[model samples]
Target: MKDFLSLSIANLLNEYIFVYDFLDSYDLKLKDDELSKSFREFFDSLDEDKLEEKGLSIDLLKEQFVNFMNAMTADADTIEELESITIVGGVNKYGEPENVELTIRKGEVICIVGPTGSGKSRLLADIEWLAQKDTPTRRQILINGKVPDKKRRFSIDHKMVAQLSQNMNFVMDLTVEEFVRMHAESRLIENADEKVSAIIDEANKLAGEQFQANTPVTSLSGGQSRALMIADTAILSRSPIILIDEIENAGIDRKKALELLVKEEKIVLMATHDPILALMGDRRLVIKNGGISKIIEVSEEERQHLPYLQALDEKLVSLRNQIRNGEILNE
Candidate 1:
């Protein structure tokens, strides 16, 4: 607290714009020349009559300022770095033991494959809630190989997982740049403009059709919206675990999106039906009867087949574009 009080006004404004805005709320705008002065010095320079007129003394003003900043940014320091997540299996839907224990480390991609309604989403929910034998599945999830504290598990501010579903729609009346900047500001990220630009650029690379920074988020197609979100989550979100559900239908570059998340060293769990997507994972979980029936490691042959699948996917994308452009299919 003392250190914060002694910081120059310029330093405080640079690090916490909320402080500047807080003072502005009280109609206490500092002069440009006062930027070099510390908060304590500024308060000391105020006359007793002025302080009394404002009904707040120097000590009271400082206390209120501290409280306001803390209230506004309470969640800024809550998220912690993650190394791995371990899933201790529980019972299947029929009350039979699942008899599976899976550990996924940072930078690893695990695919979940099963017919629809096979409880794939249940597994994701258990991990998202950090289940401690409490959820319906009764599975236990351990963070960094140990059960997380209640604050880490239950606190909304301490998010440990990021989920990207099949559908992404934006309702905010802000441009793409404005949306990313709002997130960056909330995180108090330094060089926010540069970070926002980088995120948009990366999003365009993953999107099938490129978009400009000034483009309204509401105008983005499904693919563009998903691409933006994937890049934003990979770059800005502190969550270490990323859960993706059926990204194949998102109309974006699925491989590049996964690569981006993996490059960020996040633990990725994807529930997918696409054979190519399943093969892209280091391991695939086969679900049946609401239980993990089997875990299959990507075989050497499967890895070798990835290129052919990707080429075919590219051809399909090309055909889709041609059709959208009103070109007739040729023999």
Candidate 2:
């Protein structure tokens, strides 16, 4: 289910001992009055010959144990084959119905554009809660063409969406290295040191200024903090759905930030007003009157203008850097 291939015997026995109840029917007892040992002790003391003598098949037991482990550890809240997230219908601010149906799938960047007070944030909220036609918007969200289970809607550990908001404040007083190390340890990632190093390197690339791992997370600049969080989320977070609010005003380099954030298998949805971020999406959702008025595919003509826009952006970045360096604006 959740990668039990590396699970130890101790871990397996501790996690799902109920699966071993079938052993009693085969005359192999862990709770013998003579031995009076724990299940783990019984397993460790018994050899392959002893197991065979007790009528237990080694290969068959191994296979059955793996199957049991898979079934036991699999999270019922998560959908393995999430082909698409469909939004059936929603309401506008005027209490009018939205007649649009949208599907967001894996490996696609969908941008949301709208004026102030439009339902852009509301739409994101609906997706985050996996709404079931219950909210004010009256929207129904579906996973793989079916309504998501109630467990996913309320479960804390099994979040489908990983949201990256505009503001990220580190309440903990740990250094950047310590912060990342904690996340790596929580994920039980192999080579945590290597992964932490890589995350720091990638974060520096996104930030306008580089930050040292020894620096306190609170000491980091706004751009550095955002960059670090983006890197951390990309590498460590297990949530398959990546949602982003407007990040254009943030001091981080938008291009590298997007690169570090987008995953091949993730469903990336962002709400942005910046032209560059808007055009970065494969398609843009046009929000009007507090509803998704239209969906616009990136025009081929606009695609051709990316290079020109990028060149201008680079120039602007250079100017911004000069300003940040206390240099006078040149005519």
Candidate 3:
């Protein structure tokens, strides 16, 4: 059991660092390989001798580990569960996905934004398949009261969730309408024509001025491509939870497109670098090094504060450069 806890901690640490490294590159533009390596080497150096010197009893450690794991299990309450998303208390000395607690209410637009290498994608994946048994790694993921057995497909109770990633490709043979209709037919009921019509209308509205229903998706611009992908995901999947990655591609007015999606009140978990999209979210989670560093509530206060702060910082930097280049001087 002591060995088990130690091993679990090591895994959690690795995941944390892995997530951080990935986000660092994407969000902060930092190459942190050397720092990550040092951390890993430091962790690897810990041994049983070090454990004994710390005065931690193997029996006590094992008991705590079991208790921690149990807290992450179904027995924990909702508040207890959401608390797990905060990295400080939920994660143990050894790296394990224990005590993960978060309940994303229905229809809230939640944005997961962090620098590259920060675990935005991983966090999105975790939320999509929270607390499942057979996840690639044995991280704790719980849905409602049960551990989602990895073999089971539809485990989480939150309505069917749809994920629209940057890389999901549309096959050339299928026209845009055909692709969306395929999903509409399956998810909608016997009286789906009205819903289908509404979906079409909504999709068209969201597609911006340039899109036409019959347009072969292949001919669409990059922005149009992104809009169509979003339209397909929004209309086709009946699931209330939608996960999108990097919606702010070069071409599209992704911010407006997302605002339309968010208006529907679906539980949206999106990862992007765009500050505009991040600001639009009801809640913004900052992920780094595989752990959540800060969760900013985009309330009236934050809405007013963050943009101003960022702009001020940018202005200061610009001024500093100008002064260094003799663009301005104390006279």
TM-score of each: 0.79, 0.73, 0.55
Pairwise lDDT winner, candidates 1 and 2: 1
How high is the lDDT of residue 93 in model 3? 21
Better candidate by TM-score, 1 or 2: 1
Worst 10 residues of 2 by lDDT: 31-40
Number of the top candidate by lDDT? 1
lDDT for each candidate structure: 0.85, 0.76, 0.55
- For 1-331, candidate 2 gives per-residue lDDT tens digits of 4544344434545665544554544455554352344334445455778778767665656566556556445654354556689998888778788897888887678898888778887888888889888988889899888988777766554577888887658989999999999888756456899989999998998888789999999999888888898888887777767888878545688877777666536777888877888788889988888777888999989888888888888888889878989999896
Best by TM-score: 1
Please report the TM-score between candidate 1 and the true structure: 0.79
Candidate 1 CA-lDDT value: 0.85
RMSD of 2: 9.8
